[model samples]
Target: MQFAGWLGMFAASTAVLAGCNGTDAADQSVAASQLAADECPSEGVALQVLGSGGPIAEAARAGTSYLLWIDGEPRLLIDAGAGSFLRFAEAGGNLATLDAILLTHLHADHAGDLAGILNSGGFEGRTDPLPVIGPDAAPRFPGTSEFLERLMSKEGGAFAYNGGYLDGTENKPLLRARDITTADGSGEASVLDISDDFSVTAHPVNHGVVPALGYVIEAGGKSVVITGDQSAASTLFAERLAATRPAILFAHHVINGEQGQPRGLHRTPSEIGELAGVMEPDQLVLTHNMNRSLSRIDDSRAAIGESYSGNISVAADLDCYPF
Candidate 1:
């Protein structure tokens, strides 16, 4: 989709921006109670699906978002989609503790909640600059830094009032949006960040005409690979992460290879299975669920099970999978 159309649709679909402080005491208490019941375990390294649904609205799930919890803190975030603002709060995500934000692509379902997330983080008193890494610009897409400037630039941005993030002069912290080279065959995977706890690498992937990326996060002696929306035609992703042997592989399950489906934009069930067979992740988690794919989940499982004999799971919003 074109950038303008995506932005318009996202603006219409997303809820009004209301920070955590907007809630009343009783509402906060009830939310906290619910969070306690549905939150991920705080003792180990795990991935919490803050939004498991795709671009389309699904009452049971949110859009594509994830939070990586290490020990007890929310360390990293991936894809802050439309409804993830509330899910992030429910998952006990604290920007004060979060290390960075990694975006696969600038699609509405993948990054619509970015401004909301950054604006909400101000409430937590985060002063440190946060890195927002994403794919470089393509024909119809804006680069990571340009995307942020268009949204938060002080002079003329969609949310000009929130321009503090660009320079760190206002009450909010600085947000550094770095564009990673996503050209195929660009040497090895791009190492985005590394720290004492975890290291992250960005792998280039083909998502039709859009510049896209897949991520490999290594922490706690385990590896997790998140295959952002991509076609099955390319083997670069599999070839790059062949040795990683991820503990969990979160592959996008957006379409069935039906006759009229967009084969260049997404993987079919058979394609997912093929990648799983090669990667040999300990667990294969099918995420980015859309209505069409969800309707024929049995078929998807059957197809994937042919090549992959390991565990397969269909992710749901708020579901936590430990490594």
Candidate 2:
């Protein structure tokens, strides 16, 4: 089925894009129609871009987040970045339908909306414990479980009033935060089975000093990989995922190239192309768009085209890509 209020969604999205991207009403309307046409199908595995931008507070985009739809139900949440709570609502999402929530890292842009989503879900009558998975602790970063405790713990959490999410009290469902230890110097990825139909494997990716993971999600006989803020300094992520030949590869496109941006944080456009060329995914979607990268879209596409010949798409908020 199509989304419940797709027309309203298009109007809101068009207004936001027109204001942020400096596009005219006609251009925004056409873009909105294109996104609407790619809406998730009712009986297949598809991906919905909840928040396609990076950490920046862009008017046209939210922070990085994605919803995996299976049989028309939102089954897996990849991240709940800033503004994703609203995007989820606009996309007609239901918390009761999610199987688990996966956080690639604890970055504010990637996990900022976690509590808000849980608070919203509390009123949705969901009783089963929801799983929140993320990377293990590093020198500066806390583990996934500790992060949740600090945010929702009854004792001294920032949002102690919402402690029911952690302790299963206050008439709210339980929230279980689990840490997945990615590969260290070794190249092996850590695997976790969420259900008979959904499984994920995490590989260590270089994101400055932050503990980050690149996830390869296996669902419904299809494989999809998301590289969260990875840099070209490390090749472990690409090496491990190339064999999977994922149906869709969501590569972060935060910077145009390695000139002004930090090389340890995000990959350059050429690096993204190299990764996509090695993996040979059926579709290569560039997400985590930032102002710098968005401004030079054609140049970035040309650079990526040097190494990859597959279809490359720049994702916008609420865009859907079925696999």
Candidate 3:
């Protein structure tokens, strides 16, 4: 999608921008100083869902992507999915002000627009280096370093023209990639201590060949767990959920039960409810909805409500929440 289209969409939606107060001069100054000092703030975090739809495309929602704004200025982008490049602009998130880009997994529905984001940053004349973090590379999909190498390696790469920036010769934005590794080597995952004010941890989950992950983000005295895409019955997921009590749980409602036939990977509404019940988050925000889940929105909410007493909200594209 074009940047113009995104700006148009943002201009058309008064509701999305209704609650956002433009950052005060002091806040902007703090954000700029933090960027220069490589420091992260410890309060006032906000989360926005850029693409809440699942693998299967939906007109109402895009794929799975989230924008987390910290201290009212610095933005952390998670999972740049197919339409997320446009959605980010539509959300009025400044790509130039982005602090970092974190990917849960290499699934196309999750990290498809990573290159597009880099390209957009270059186009916007951003000269600062941006950090890209994700799991180690596998045969199926490239890891963080390899992914960037393939883009700007200077040897038969897509964005080879920008290699001068990688060498610090030209005044182009540098793209840095960081691969997260697990401790036990059971699978690749890691807990990223972003700063004193915030942290993020990734746990391997069941998603067929995709090497899926779920993230736990902590900031501003609140925490949020985002389950990218996983099998509801996976015990690893339960173990991870048991470790922390998040303020909000953004779970996928894929609904994978059909006449007793087992679905490959992904959760059913009932399974999500059980997990939410175990985690006991303050609120449950269902996201990454497909037709199966969207058609049964009411049923999904009711099923989760049976197991969890907290507030339940079905996420939509560009949904905003204060954390």
TM-score of each: 0.86, 0.90, 0.79
RMSD of each: 8.9, 3.1, 9.4
lDDT of 3 by residue, 1-323 (tens): 13334434444343234325553444434222211211122357867788887777655566789988676564688898887777776666666777778887777778878777666666676777777777666667677678778777788678788675465446666767787652222354577655566787777676655556678888877899887777764667677567367889999777733221134577677778888888988888988877666666777777677778789887767666677
Model 3 alpha-carbon miss at residue 185, Å: 10
Runs in model 1 deviating more than 4 A are 1-38, 184-188, 257-260
State each model's CA lDDT, in order: 0.80, 0.81, 0.69
How do the residues 236-266 of candidate 2 rate in per-residue lDDT, one tens digit apiece? Answer: 7777667567899999998865574876688
Residue 91 Cα positional deviation in candidate 3, in Å, after optimal superposition? 1.1
- Number of the candidate with higher TM-score, 1 or 3: 1
TM-score: which candidate is best? 2
Q: Which of 1 and 3 is the better model by lDDT?
A: 1
lDDT (Cα, tens digit) per residue for candidate 1, span 1-323? 12223333443333222233463445334333322323556588888888888999866467899899888788999999898887787677878887889999999999999889888887777778988899899788998899999999998999999898899877777887889877642425788754678999888888887888898888878999999998875578887777567899999998864442778888888889989999999999999987789889999999888889999988877778788
lDDT ranking from best candidate downward: 2, 1, 3
